[model samples]
Target: MYDRPYPGNLYIHEILNGHDVRAYNYFRMPAQVFTGLRDLLADRGVLRDTRFM
Candidate 1:
């Protein structure tokens, strides 16, 4: 998500809540995978907002 900046945000000039919902779907991804992706995003300077994660 972070890699894409406005990940999953297709709306024109609107906040993209799709990625948030995707991340919130715990059943979709493993906990470790989600954490790893989040960390990766943070490390790569994609996750600028800590509160978002």
Candidate 2:
């Protein structure tokens, strides 16, 4: 998300941190892949039996 430093950076810096700061962006890349896997698990009804549901 460093490459997408438009609204994302602004939002994190201005709203989240209240100033310029370095922080991890949990919105793209590996996060997206993990979210996709979670969605897939939900679609397969696997998470229905787990606390993740």
For TM-score, the strongest prediction is 1
**Which regions of candidate 1 fall more than 4 Å away from where they truly are?**
1-27, 51-53
Give per-model TM-scores.
Answer: 0.42, 0.36
- Give the lowest summed-lDDT range of ten residues in model 2: 15-24
Model 2 gets an lDDT of 0.48
Instruction: Write the residue-wise lDDT of candidate 2 on 1-53 in tens digits.
Output: 35655654354434334322222243334444555776899899886543322
* Residue-by-residue lDDT tens digits, candidate 1, 21-42: 4444633665456667868999
